[model samples]
Target: MIKIFRITAKNKILILGSNGQLGSHLSNDLAKLGEVTSLDRNGFNFENPESLDLIIKRLSPKFIINAAAFTNVDGAEDFEKIAYQVNALTVKKLAILAHENNAVLIHFSTDYVFDGLKEEPYLENDIARPISVYGNSKLEGENYINEICSKYLILRTSGVISKNEDNFISKIINLSNDRDELNIVSDQQSSLNFSGFISQAVLEILTELESNIDKEKRWGIYHLSGQEPGTWYEFAKFTQEISKKINPDSNFSKIDINPIPSTQFIQKAKRPKYSFLSSVKLKEDFGIELPNWKKSIIEVMENNE
Candidate 1:
Protein backbone atom coordinates (compact mmCIF):
# COMPACT_ATOMS: atom_id res chain seq x y z
CA MET A 1 0.00 0.00 0.00
CA ILE A 2 1.27 3.46 -0.89
CA LYS A 3 1.19 5.97 1.96
CA ILE A 4 0.73 9.47 0.62
CA PHE A 5 1.64 12.60 2.53
CA ARG A 6 -0.97 15.30 3.03
CA ILE A 7 0.45 17.36 0.23
CA THR A 8 -1.44 19.55 -2.16
CA ALA A 9 -0.18 20.85 -5.48
CA LYS A 10 1.16 23.89 -3.65
CA ASN A 11 3.48 22.29 -1.10
CA LYS A 12 6.31 24.70 -0.24
CA ILE A 13 9.85 23.37 -0.92
CA LEU A 14 13.25 24.87 -0.22
CA ILE A 15 16.35 24.20 -2.32
CA LEU A 16 19.65 25.14 -0.73
CA GLY A 17 22.49 26.15 -3.07
CA SER A 18 19.84 26.75 -5.72
CA ASN A 19 22.37 28.79 -7.76
CA GLY A 20 24.84 25.93 -8.27
CA GLN A 21 24.90 23.82 -11.42
CA LEU A 22 22.99 20.87 -9.95
CA GLY A 23 20.89 23.09 -7.71
CA SER A 24 19.88 25.26 -10.67
CA HIS A 25 18.64 22.21 -12.54
CA LEU A 26 16.91 20.81 -9.45
CA SER A 27 15.16 24.09 -8.71
CA ASN A 28 13.79 24.23 -12.26
CA ASP A 29 12.48 20.65 -12.24
CA LEU A 30 11.08 20.92 -8.71
CA ALA A 31 9.06 23.95 -9.82
CA LYS A 32 7.01 21.57 -11.96
CA LEU A 33 5.93 19.69 -8.84
CA GLY A 34 5.20 22.46 -6.35
CA GLU A 35 6.06 25.92 -5.02
CA VAL A 36 9.86 25.83 -4.76
CA THR A 37 11.79 28.49 -2.83
CA SER A 38 15.19 28.69 -4.43
CA LEU A 39 18.02 30.13 -2.33
CA ASP A 40 21.23 31.18 -3.96
CA ARG A 41 24.46 32.49 -2.43
CA ASN A 42 22.91 35.85 -1.71
CA GLY A 43 20.19 34.33 0.41
CA PHE A 44 21.68 31.13 1.83
CA ASN A 45 25.12 30.90 3.41
CA PHE A 46 25.87 27.39 4.64
CA GLU A 47 28.41 28.70 7.15
CA ASN A 48 25.76 30.48 9.16
CA PRO A 49 23.79 27.91 11.15
CA GLU A 50 21.40 30.32 12.83
CA SER A 51 20.45 31.96 9.56
CA LEU A 52 19.89 28.53 8.01
CA ASP A 53 17.67 27.54 10.91
CA LEU A 54 15.65 30.70 10.52
CA ILE A 55 15.30 30.18 6.79
CA ILE A 56 14.03 26.62 7.27
CA LYS A 57 11.59 27.78 9.92
CA ARG A 58 10.29 30.60 7.75
CA LEU A 59 9.88 28.34 4.72
CA SER A 60 8.66 25.33 6.69
CA PRO A 61 9.12 23.15 3.67
CA LYS A 62 8.17 19.47 3.57
CA PHE A 63 11.30 18.69 1.58
CA ILE A 64 14.77 20.24 1.86
CA ILE A 65 17.26 19.44 -0.86
CA ASN A 66 20.85 20.56 -0.22
CA ALA A 67 22.99 20.71 -3.34
CA ALA A 68 25.66 23.08 -2.07
CA ALA A 69 29.16 21.99 -1.10
CA PHE A 70 32.71 23.34 -0.81
CA THR A 71 33.60 21.63 -4.07
CA ASN A 72 37.00 23.12 -4.73
CA VAL A 73 39.08 19.94 -4.32
CA ASP A 74 42.45 21.63 -3.94
CA GLY A 75 41.11 24.57 -2.04
CA ALA A 76 39.59 22.22 0.52
CA GLU A 77 43.06 21.10 1.62
CA ASP A 78 43.98 24.59 2.73
CA PHE A 79 40.50 25.49 3.96
CA GLU A 80 39.55 22.43 5.97
CA LYS A 81 37.72 24.56 8.54
CA ILE A 82 35.53 26.21 5.95
CA ALA A 83 34.99 22.89 4.23
CA TYR A 84 33.93 21.20 7.46
CA GLN A 85 31.70 24.10 8.38
CA VAL A 86 29.87 24.10 5.07
CA ASN A 87 29.97 20.40 4.21
CA ALA A 88 29.72 18.72 7.61
CA LEU A 89 28.38 21.19 10.18
CA THR A 90 25.74 22.75 7.98
CA VAL A 91 24.44 19.34 6.93
CA LYS A 92 24.33 18.23 10.56
CA LYS A 93 22.34 21.29 11.51
CA LEU A 94 20.02 20.77 8.56
CA ALA A 95 19.50 17.11 9.50
CA ILE A 96 18.52 18.10 13.03
CA LEU A 97 16.09 20.67 11.73
CA ALA A 98 14.56 18.20 9.28
CA HIS A 99 14.10 15.61 12.04
CA GLU A 100 12.54 18.16 14.35
CA ASN A 101 9.98 19.15 11.72
CA ASN A 102 9.55 15.57 10.40
CA ALA A 103 10.55 16.84 6.97
CA VAL A 104 12.45 14.72 4.47
CA LEU A 105 15.94 15.92 3.62
CA ILE A 106 17.77 14.94 0.46
CA HIS A 107 21.51 15.54 0.41
CA PHE A 108 24.08 15.11 -2.34
CA SER A 109 27.43 13.53 -1.57
CA THR A 110 30.51 12.47 -3.56
CA ASP A 111 32.50 9.30 -4.29
CA TYR A 112 35.48 10.96 -2.64
CA VAL A 113 34.34 9.30 0.58
CA PHE A 114 36.19 6.19 -0.60
CA ASP A 115 39.96 5.65 -0.64
CA GLY A 116 39.69 4.60 -4.30
CA LEU A 117 42.12 1.73 -4.00
CA LYS A 118 39.78 -1.01 -5.16
CA GLU A 119 39.94 -2.25 -8.74
CA GLU A 120 36.16 -2.71 -8.80
CA PRO A 121 33.45 -0.11 -8.43
CA TYR A 122 32.49 0.92 -4.87
CA LEU A 123 29.22 -0.20 -3.29
CA GLU A 124 27.19 1.84 -0.84
CA ASN A 125 28.14 -0.47 1.99
CA ASP A 126 31.86 -0.43 1.18
CA ILE A 127 34.27 0.84 3.79
CA ALA A 128 34.91 4.56 3.41
CA ARG A 129 38.52 5.59 3.75
CA PRO A 130 38.81 9.13 2.41
CA ILE A 131 42.34 10.12 1.44
CA SER A 132 41.90 13.89 1.53
CA VAL A 133 40.43 16.55 3.75
CA TYR A 134 37.56 17.17 1.34
CA GLY A 135 36.62 13.49 1.26
CA ASN A 136 36.89 13.15 5.02
CA SER A 137 34.76 16.22 5.59
CA LYS A 138 32.06 15.02 3.24
CA LEU A 139 32.06 11.55 4.80
CA GLU A 140 31.68 13.16 8.20
CA GLY A 141 28.72 15.09 6.92
CA GLU A 142 27.07 11.92 5.56
CA ASN A 143 27.67 10.12 8.84
CA TYR A 144 26.25 12.98 10.87
CA ILE A 145 23.08 13.02 8.79
CA ASN A 146 22.63 9.26 9.05
CA GLU A 147 23.15 9.39 12.80
CA ILE A 148 20.90 12.37 13.47
CA CYS A 149 18.13 12.20 10.91
CA SER A 150 15.82 9.22 10.59
CA LYS A 151 14.14 10.39 7.38
CA TYR A 152 16.94 11.35 5.00
CA LEU A 153 18.33 10.32 1.65
CA ILE A 154 22.06 10.58 1.02
CA LEU A 155 23.12 10.27 -2.62
CA ARG A 156 26.79 9.61 -3.33
CA THR A 157 27.96 10.18 -6.88
CA SER A 158 31.16 10.99 -8.78
CA GLY A 159 32.73 13.01 -11.66
CA VAL A 160 30.03 15.62 -12.24
CA ILE A 161 30.02 17.68 -15.48
CA SER A 162 27.46 20.03 -16.94
CA LYS A 163 27.12 22.38 -19.91
CA ASN A 164 25.12 25.16 -18.25
CA GLU A 165 27.34 26.24 -15.39
CA ASP A 166 30.89 26.88 -14.07
CA ASN A 167 31.94 23.25 -14.27
CA PHE A 168 34.52 21.04 -15.99
CA ILE A 169 32.79 21.17 -19.36
CA SER A 170 32.70 24.97 -19.56
CA LYS A 171 36.22 25.28 -18.20
CA ILE A 172 37.52 22.90 -20.85
CA ILE A 173 35.69 24.76 -23.63
CA ASN A 174 36.97 28.11 -22.43
CA LEU A 175 40.53 26.90 -21.90
CA SER A 176 40.65 25.07 -25.23
CA ASN A 177 39.49 28.22 -26.97
CA ASP A 178 42.57 30.06 -25.68
CA ARG A 179 45.11 27.20 -25.92
CA ASP A 180 45.48 24.43 -28.44
CA GLU A 181 46.25 21.74 -25.87
CA LEU A 182 44.92 21.01 -22.37
CA ASN A 183 46.27 18.58 -19.79
CA ILE A 184 43.69 16.60 -17.89
CA VAL A 185 44.39 14.13 -15.13
CA SER A 186 44.48 10.66 -16.64
CA ASP A 187 45.05 8.45 -13.62
CA GLN A 188 41.85 9.07 -11.71
CA GLN A 189 38.80 7.08 -12.84
CA SER A 190 35.07 7.60 -12.22
CA SER A 191 31.70 8.16 -13.86
CA LEU A 192 30.81 11.54 -15.43
CA ASN A 193 27.25 12.83 -15.13
CA PHE A 194 25.18 15.81 -16.25
CA SER A 195 23.62 18.18 -13.74
CA GLY A 196 20.27 18.03 -15.46
CA PHE A 197 20.14 14.24 -15.29
CA ILE A 198 20.98 14.31 -11.59
CA SER A 199 18.28 16.87 -10.88
CA GLN A 200 15.66 14.87 -12.73
CA ALA A 201 16.50 11.74 -10.76
CA VAL A 202 16.27 13.67 -7.49
CA LEU A 203 12.85 14.97 -8.39
CA GLU A 204 11.68 11.45 -9.23
CA ILE A 205 12.91 10.09 -5.91
CA LEU A 206 11.25 12.93 -4.02
CA THR A 207 7.98 12.42 -5.84
CA GLU A 208 8.05 8.72 -5.10
CA LEU A 209 8.63 9.37 -1.41
CA GLU A 210 5.89 12.00 -1.17
CA SER A 211 3.37 9.85 -3.03
CA ASN A 212 4.19 6.55 -1.29
CA ILE A 213 5.49 6.86 2.21
CA ASP A 214 4.96 3.16 2.89
CA LYS A 215 7.22 2.23 -0.02
CA GLU A 216 10.06 0.94 2.11
CA LYS A 217 12.08 0.42 -1.04
CA ARG A 218 12.40 4.16 -1.74
CA TRP A 219 15.07 5.56 0.56
CA GLY A 220 18.82 5.61 1.51
CA ILE A 221 22.15 6.28 -0.26
CA TYR A 222 21.97 5.50 -3.94
CA HIS A 223 24.99 5.87 -6.22
CA LEU A 224 23.80 8.23 -8.97
CA SER A 225 26.29 9.00 -11.78
CA GLY A 226 27.19 8.06 -15.36
CA GLN A 227 27.13 4.42 -16.41
CA GLU A 228 30.40 3.55 -18.12
CA PRO A 229 33.49 4.66 -16.21
CA GLY A 230 36.59 6.22 -17.81
CA THR A 231 39.74 8.07 -16.96
CA TRP A 232 39.84 11.86 -16.97
CA TYR A 233 42.03 11.90 -20.08
CA GLU A 234 39.50 9.89 -22.07
CA PHE A 235 36.75 12.23 -20.86
CA ALA A 236 38.84 15.27 -21.93
CA LYS A 237 39.55 13.77 -25.34
CA PHE A 238 35.87 13.15 -25.87
CA THR A 239 35.13 16.74 -24.86
CA GLN A 240 37.63 18.08 -27.40
CA GLU A 241 36.24 15.91 -30.19
CA ILE A 242 32.70 16.93 -29.35
CA SER A 243 33.65 20.60 -29.24
CA LYS A 244 35.25 20.44 -32.71
CA LYS A 245 31.91 19.42 -34.20
CA ILE A 246 30.10 22.20 -32.31
CA ASN A 247 32.69 24.85 -33.31
CA PRO A 248 34.33 23.78 -36.59
CA ASP A 249 35.42 27.28 -37.61
CA SER A 250 37.14 27.88 -34.29
CA ASN A 251 40.90 27.34 -34.45
CA PHE A 252 41.81 24.96 -31.65
CA SER A 253 45.10 23.13 -31.63
CA LYS A 254 45.02 19.36 -31.46
CA ILE A 255 47.14 19.10 -28.35
CA ASP A 256 48.66 15.85 -27.20
CA ILE A 257 46.92 14.57 -24.06
CA ASN A 258 49.49 13.19 -21.64
CA PRO A 259 48.36 10.36 -19.36
CA ILE A 260 50.26 10.91 -16.14
CA PRO A 261 50.21 9.05 -12.87
CA SER A 262 48.45 10.48 -9.83
CA THR A 263 51.86 11.25 -8.28
CA GLN A 264 52.64 13.53 -11.21
CA PHE A 265 49.66 15.74 -10.47
CA ILE A 266 50.89 17.82 -7.55
CA GLN A 267 48.14 19.27 -5.43
CA LYS A 268 47.35 20.52 -1.92
CA ALA A 269 45.28 17.40 -1.24
CA LYS A 270 45.40 13.74 -2.14
CA ARG A 271 42.74 12.22 -4.44
CA PRO A 272 41.13 8.84 -4.92
CA LYS A 273 42.80 7.10 -7.83
CA TYR A 274 39.70 4.97 -8.51
CA SER A 275 36.45 6.41 -7.22
CA PHE A 276 33.98 4.75 -9.57
CA LEU A 277 30.79 3.75 -7.72
CA SER A 278 28.69 0.69 -8.56
CA SER A 279 25.11 1.54 -9.55
CA VAL A 280 23.88 -2.05 -9.19
CA LYS A 281 22.20 -1.37 -5.87
CA LEU A 282 20.45 1.72 -7.10
CA LYS A 283 19.35 -0.04 -10.25
CA GLU A 284 18.20 -3.17 -8.47
CA ASP A 285 16.54 -1.27 -5.64
CA PHE A 286 15.02 1.79 -7.28
CA GLY A 287 14.77 0.73 -10.94
CA ILE A 288 16.92 3.74 -11.83
CA GLU A 289 19.32 3.58 -14.74
CA LEU A 290 22.36 5.81 -15.08
CA PRO A 291 23.49 6.58 -18.63
CA ASN A 292 27.00 5.89 -19.85
CA TRP A 293 29.60 8.63 -19.45
CA LYS A 294 30.16 9.14 -23.20
CA LYS A 295 26.43 9.16 -23.95
CA SER A 296 25.75 11.67 -21.18
CA ILE A 297 28.52 13.99 -22.42
CA ILE A 298 27.35 13.85 -26.03
CA GLU A 299 23.76 14.57 -25.05
CA VAL A 300 24.79 17.50 -22.88
CA MET A 301 27.03 18.93 -25.61
CA GLU A 302 24.34 18.53 -28.23
CA ASN A 303 21.81 20.19 -25.95
CA ASN A 304 24.12 23.17 -25.50
CA GLU A 305 24.66 23.55 -29.24
Candidate 2:
Protein backbone atom coordinates (compact mmCIF):
# COMPACT_ATOMS: atom_id res chain seq x y z
CA MET A 1 0.00 0.00 0.00
CA ILE A 2 1.10 3.60 -0.58
CA LYS A 3 2.22 5.24 2.66
CA ILE A 4 0.06 8.35 2.94
CA PHE A 5 1.49 11.41 4.65
CA ARG A 6 -0.38 13.72 6.99
CA ILE A 7 1.05 16.83 8.61
CA THR A 8 0.32 17.53 12.28
CA ALA A 9 -1.20 20.99 12.06
CA LYS A 10 -3.16 20.46 8.82
CA ASN A 11 -1.76 23.18 6.56
CA LYS A 12 -4.33 24.91 4.36
CA ILE A 13 -3.82 23.89 0.70
CA LEU A 14 -5.70 25.82 -1.98
CA ILE A 15 -6.24 23.93 -5.27
CA LEU A 16 -7.01 25.79 -8.47
CA GLY A 17 -8.64 23.98 -11.43
CA SER A 18 -10.40 21.54 -9.08
CA ASN A 19 -12.70 20.53 -11.93
CA GLY A 20 -9.84 19.37 -14.17
CA GLN A 21 -8.54 15.78 -14.48
CA LEU A 22 -5.47 16.42 -12.32
CA GLY A 23 -7.18 18.95 -10.09
CA SER A 24 -9.92 16.43 -9.21
CA HIS A 25 -7.41 13.82 -8.05
CA LEU A 26 -5.18 16.37 -6.29
CA SER A 27 -8.21 17.59 -4.34
CA ASN A 28 -8.66 14.19 -2.67
CA ASP A 29 -4.98 13.24 -2.34
CA LEU A 30 -3.79 16.64 -1.05
CA ALA A 31 -6.46 16.37 1.64
CA LYS A 32 -4.34 13.64 3.28
CA LEU A 33 -1.54 16.17 3.70
CA GLY A 34 -3.63 19.19 4.69
CA GLU A 35 -6.99 20.94 4.50
CA VAL A 36 -7.75 21.18 0.74
CA THR A 37 -9.90 24.08 -0.37
CA SER A 38 -10.88 23.13 -3.95
CA LEU A 39 -12.03 25.76 -6.42
CA ASP A 40 -13.19 24.66 -9.85
CA ARG A 41 -14.47 26.52 -12.90
CA ASN A 42 -17.62 27.60 -11.08
CA GLY A 43 -15.79 29.35 -8.26
CA PHE A 44 -12.21 30.19 -9.20
CA ASN A 45 -12.60 30.45 -12.93
CA PHE A 46 -9.38 31.52 -14.66
CA GLU A 47 -11.46 33.44 -17.18
CA ASN A 48 -11.97 35.98 -14.41
CA PRO A 49 -8.39 36.71 -13.35
CA GLU A 50 -9.11 39.86 -11.34
CA SER A 51 -11.23 37.99 -8.78
CA LEU A 52 -8.32 35.73 -7.71
CA ASP A 53 -6.64 38.49 -5.68
CA LEU A 54 -9.46 38.71 -3.15
CA ILE A 55 -9.84 34.94 -2.77
CA ILE A 56 -6.10 34.22 -2.27
CA LYS A 57 -5.85 37.05 0.28
CA ARG A 58 -8.91 35.77 2.15
CA LEU A 59 -7.70 32.16 2.22
CA SER A 60 -4.01 32.90 2.82
CA PRO A 61 -3.28 29.27 2.23
CA LYS A 62 0.12 27.89 3.12
CA PHE A 63 0.32 26.07 -0.21
CA ILE A 64 -1.26 26.99 -3.53
CA ILE A 65 -1.59 24.10 -5.99
CA ASN A 66 -2.45 25.19 -9.53
CA ALA A 67 -3.86 22.26 -11.46
CA ALA A 68 -5.82 24.45 -13.87
CA ALA A 69 -5.03 25.76 -17.39
CA PHE A 70 -6.34 26.20 -20.93
CA THR A 71 -5.57 22.76 -22.34
CA ASN A 72 -7.45 22.75 -25.64
CA VAL A 73 -4.68 22.45 -28.20
CA ASP A 74 -6.80 23.01 -31.29
CA GLY A 75 -9.17 25.53 -29.78
CA ALA A 76 -6.30 27.68 -28.56
CA GLU A 77 -5.51 28.60 -32.16
CA ASP A 78 -8.87 30.32 -32.48
CA PHE A 79 -9.35 31.58 -28.92
CA GLU A 80 -5.94 32.86 -27.90
CA LYS A 81 -7.37 35.53 -25.59
CA ILE A 82 -8.90 33.18 -23.04
CA ALA A 83 -5.97 30.79 -23.40
CA TYR A 84 -3.46 33.45 -22.37
CA GLN A 85 -5.86 34.77 -19.74
CA VAL A 86 -6.23 31.43 -18.01
CA ASN A 87 -2.78 29.97 -18.62
CA ALA A 88 -0.54 33.04 -18.29
CA LEU A 89 -2.29 36.10 -16.83
CA THR A 90 -4.13 34.22 -14.10
CA VAL A 91 -0.99 32.28 -13.18
CA LYS A 92 0.85 35.57 -12.74
CA LYS A 93 -1.73 36.60 -10.16
CA LEU A 94 -1.45 33.30 -8.28
CA ALA A 95 2.36 33.55 -8.17
CA ILE A 96 2.16 37.08 -6.79
CA LEU A 97 -0.36 35.96 -4.21
CA ALA A 98 1.83 33.06 -3.14
CA HIS A 99 4.82 35.38 -2.92
CA GLU A 100 2.94 37.89 -0.75
CA ASN A 101 1.63 35.19 1.59
CA ASN A 102 5.02 33.43 1.76
CA ALA A 103 3.28 30.27 0.56
CA VAL A 104 4.68 27.56 -1.68
CA LEU A 105 3.28 27.73 -5.20
CA ILE A 106 3.11 24.42 -7.04
CA HIS A 107 2.28 25.02 -10.71
CA PHE A 108 1.75 22.48 -13.50
CA SER A 109 3.20 23.04 -16.98
CA THR A 110 3.19 21.04 -20.24
CA ASP A 111 5.79 19.18 -22.30
CA TYR A 112 4.47 21.21 -25.22
CA VAL A 113 6.78 23.98 -24.02
CA PHE A 114 9.46 22.21 -26.02
CA ASP A 115 9.12 22.00 -29.83
CA GLY A 116 9.66 18.22 -29.71
CA LEU A 117 12.60 18.54 -32.05
CA LYS A 118 15.07 17.01 -29.62
CA GLU A 119 16.12 13.41 -30.20
CA GLU A 120 15.89 12.56 -26.51
CA PRO A 121 13.37 13.20 -23.75
CA TYR A 122 13.09 16.84 -22.59
CA LEU A 123 15.27 17.99 -19.69
CA GLU A 124 14.36 20.76 -17.25
CA ASN A 125 17.02 23.05 -18.72
CA ASP A 126 16.01 22.52 -22.35
CA ILE A 127 15.33 25.72 -24.28
CA ALA A 128 11.54 25.94 -24.56
CA ARG A 129 10.34 26.67 -28.07
CA PRO A 130 6.60 26.08 -28.21
CA ILE A 131 5.05 25.21 -31.57
CA SER A 132 1.48 26.13 -30.69
CA VAL A 133 -0.45 28.87 -28.93
CA TYR A 134 -1.51 26.61 -26.07
CA GLY A 135 2.07 25.52 -25.44
CA ASN A 136 3.37 29.09 -25.52
CA SER A 137 0.71 30.20 -23.07
CA LYS A 138 1.57 27.40 -20.64
CA LEU A 139 5.28 28.29 -20.87
CA GLU A 140 4.36 31.89 -20.06
CA GLY A 141 2.64 30.69 -16.92
CA GLU A 142 5.78 28.80 -15.88
CA ASN A 143 7.82 31.95 -16.46
CA TYR A 144 5.54 33.93 -14.17
CA ILE A 145 6.09 31.49 -11.30
CA ASN A 146 9.85 31.52 -11.88
CA GLU A 147 10.13 35.29 -12.05
CA ILE A 148 7.84 36.33 -9.19
CA CYS A 149 7.94 33.55 -6.59
CA SER A 150 10.87 32.35 -4.50
CA LYS A 151 9.21 29.38 -2.82
CA TYR A 152 7.84 27.60 -5.86
CA LEU A 153 7.80 24.28 -7.69
CA ILE A 154 6.95 24.08 -11.41
CA LEU A 155 6.19 20.55 -12.62
CA ARG A 156 6.04 20.00 -16.37
CA THR A 157 4.26 16.83 -17.54
CA SER A 158 2.52 15.50 -20.67
CA GLY A 159 -0.27 13.22 -21.97
CA VAL A 160 -1.91 13.27 -18.51
CA ILE A 161 -4.81 10.83 -17.97
CA SER A 162 -7.41 10.39 -15.26
CA LYS A 163 -10.31 8.00 -14.74
CA ASN A 164 -12.45 10.99 -13.77
CA GLU A 165 -11.99 13.39 -16.70
CA ASP A 166 -12.49 13.13 -20.49
CA ASN A 167 -8.88 12.16 -21.07
CA PHE A 168 -7.24 9.95 -23.70
CA ILE A 169 -8.34 6.76 -21.91
CA SER A 170 -11.94 7.93 -21.64
CA LYS A 171 -11.89 9.04 -25.26
CA ILE A 172 -10.78 5.61 -26.45
CA ILE A 173 -13.52 3.96 -24.42
CA ASN A 174 -16.17 6.35 -25.70
CA LEU A 175 -15.07 5.97 -29.30
CA SER A 176 -15.13 2.18 -28.96
CA ASN A 177 -18.82 2.38 -28.06
CA ASP A 178 -19.94 2.91 -31.69
CA ARG A 179 -16.89 2.73 -33.94
CA ASP A 180 -15.58 -0.67 -34.92
CA GLU A 181 -12.19 0.79 -35.98
CA LEU A 182 -10.25 3.95 -35.13
CA ASN A 183 -7.40 5.80 -36.80
CA ILE A 184 -5.05 7.13 -34.09
CA VAL A 185 -1.96 9.25 -34.62
CA SER A 186 1.21 7.21 -34.32
CA ASP A 187 3.87 9.60 -35.57
CA GLN A 188 3.75 11.65 -32.35
CA GLN A 189 5.63 10.24 -29.36
CA SER A 190 5.17 11.22 -25.70
CA SER A 191 4.72 9.86 -22.20
CA LEU A 192 1.29 9.00 -20.75
CA ASN A 193 1.00 9.98 -17.05
CA PHE A 194 -1.93 9.12 -14.82
CA SER A 195 -3.43 11.73 -12.53
CA GLY A 196 -3.21 9.46 -9.52
CA PHE A 197 0.52 9.07 -10.07
CA ILE A 198 1.00 12.80 -10.56
CA SER A 199 -0.96 13.57 -7.40
CA GLN A 200 1.01 11.08 -5.31
CA ALA A 201 4.30 12.53 -6.56
CA VAL A 202 3.18 16.04 -5.53
CA LEU A 203 2.09 14.78 -2.13
CA GLU A 204 5.42 13.06 -1.58
CA ILE A 205 7.26 16.26 -2.49
CA LEU A 206 5.20 18.23 0.01
CA THR A 207 5.82 15.59 2.62
CA GLU A 208 9.56 15.76 1.96
CA LEU A 209 9.60 19.53 2.28
CA GLU A 210 7.12 19.66 5.15
CA SER A 211 5.94 23.00 3.76
CA ASN A 212 9.39 24.49 4.20
CA ILE A 213 9.85 27.97 2.66
CA ASP A 214 13.61 28.06 3.00
CA LYS A 215 15.68 28.40 -0.15
CA GLU A 216 16.78 25.08 -1.66
CA LYS A 217 18.01 23.87 -5.02
CA ARG A 218 14.96 21.53 -5.17
CA TRP A 219 12.63 24.52 -5.56
CA GLY A 220 12.55 24.71 -9.34
CA ILE A 221 11.03 23.17 -12.48
CA TYR A 222 11.14 19.37 -12.82
CA HIS A 223 10.03 17.06 -15.65
CA LEU A 224 7.64 14.52 -14.08
CA SER A 225 6.16 12.04 -16.59
CA GLY A 226 5.69 8.35 -17.40
CA GLN A 227 8.35 5.67 -17.26
CA GLU A 228 8.42 5.15 -21.02
CA PRO A 229 7.60 6.91 -24.27
CA GLY A 230 4.82 5.72 -26.62
CA THR A 231 2.44 7.01 -29.24
CA TRP A 232 -1.34 7.40 -29.09
CA TYR A 233 -1.70 4.40 -31.37
CA GLU A 234 0.25 2.26 -28.93
CA PHE A 235 -1.65 3.64 -25.94
CA ALA A 236 -5.00 2.75 -27.55
CA LYS A 237 -3.94 -0.77 -28.49
CA PHE A 238 -2.58 -1.33 -24.98
CA THR A 239 -5.87 -0.22 -23.50
CA GLN A 240 -7.58 -2.83 -25.62
CA GLU A 241 -5.07 -5.44 -24.51
CA ILE A 242 -5.67 -4.62 -20.83
CA SER A 243 -9.46 -4.55 -21.18
CA LYS A 244 -9.46 -8.06 -22.64
CA LYS A 245 -7.16 -9.38 -19.91
CA ILE A 246 -9.21 -7.95 -17.05
CA ASN A 247 -12.65 -8.67 -18.57
CA PRO A 248 -12.84 -11.18 -21.41
CA ASP A 249 -16.40 -10.14 -22.17
CA SER A 250 -15.46 -6.52 -22.78
CA ASN A 251 -16.04 -4.85 -26.19
CA PHE A 252 -12.43 -3.69 -26.56
CA SER A 253 -11.52 -6.78 -28.56
CA LYS A 254 -14.03 -5.86 -31.23
CA ILE A 255 -12.46 -2.47 -31.93
CA ASP A 256 -9.43 -2.16 -34.22
CA ILE A 257 -6.94 0.71 -33.72
CA ASN A 258 -5.09 1.74 -36.87
CA PRO A 259 -1.90 3.80 -36.67
CA ILE A 260 -1.63 6.83 -38.95
CA PRO A 261 0.59 9.84 -39.42
CA SER A 262 -0.27 13.29 -38.03
CA THR A 263 -0.99 14.57 -41.53
CA GLN A 264 -3.94 12.20 -41.74
CA PHE A 265 -5.76 14.25 -39.12
CA ILE A 266 -5.95 17.98 -39.77
CA GLN A 267 -6.06 20.27 -36.73
CA LYS A 268 -5.79 23.98 -36.03
CA ALA A 269 -2.77 23.70 -33.72
CA LYS A 270 0.61 22.08 -34.33
CA ARG A 271 1.68 19.31 -31.91
CA PRO A 272 5.24 18.26 -31.19
CA LYS A 273 6.20 14.94 -32.73
CA TYR A 274 8.26 14.07 -29.64
CA SER A 275 7.20 15.97 -26.53
CA PHE A 276 7.86 13.33 -23.85
CA LEU A 277 9.76 14.44 -20.70
CA SER A 278 12.50 12.77 -18.62
CA SER A 279 11.79 11.80 -15.00
CA VAL A 280 15.48 11.42 -14.05
CA LYS A 281 15.65 14.71 -12.16
CA LEU A 282 12.45 13.97 -10.29
CA LYS A 283 13.87 10.64 -9.16
CA GLU A 284 17.22 12.18 -8.30
CA ASP A 285 15.67 14.78 -6.00
CA PHE A 286 12.52 13.09 -4.56
CA GLY A 287 13.29 9.36 -5.00
CA ILE A 288 9.98 8.85 -6.83
CA GLU A 289 9.78 6.68 -9.93
CA LEU A 290 6.37 6.37 -11.62
CA PRO A 291 5.20 3.06 -12.99
CA ASN A 292 4.92 2.30 -16.71
CA TRP A 293 2.05 3.68 -18.77
CA LYS A 294 0.75 0.16 -19.33
CA LYS A 295 0.09 -0.34 -15.61
CA SER A 296 -1.81 2.92 -15.45
CA ILE A 297 -3.87 1.78 -18.47
CA ILE A 298 -4.78 -1.44 -16.71
CA GLU A 299 -5.96 0.38 -13.58
CA VAL A 300 -7.87 2.94 -15.64
CA MET A 301 -9.58 0.20 -17.66
CA GLU A 302 -10.44 -1.69 -14.51
CA ASN A 303 -12.12 1.36 -13.02
CA ASN A 304 -13.94 2.31 -16.24
CA GLU A 305 -15.20 -1.21 -16.81
TM-scores of all models?
Answer: 0.92, 0.94
TM-score of model 2 vs. true structure: 0.94
Model 2 over residues 1-305: C-alpha lDDT tens digits?
11223435468888888878888889888888787788888777888777788888887888999998889998899999999999999899889889998888999999999998996888999999999999999999999999999989999988888787478988877887788788999999997888888899999998887745464558999988877999999999888888777766756666778999999989899999998899899999989888788877876777763
The segments of candidate 1 whose C-alpha lies over 4 angstroms from its true place after superposition are 1-8, 214-217, 251-253
- lDDT of each residue in 1-305, candidate 1, tens digit only: 11122346666778888777788888789877777878876777888777877777877888888998999888999999999999999889999999898778889999999998996889999999999989999999999998988778899988777766566667766776667567788888988888878888887777777777655455677888767789988887887687678866554325555677777778888888898998888778667777888877887777884
TM-score: which candidate is best? 2
Candidate 2 regions exceeding 4 Å error are 1-8
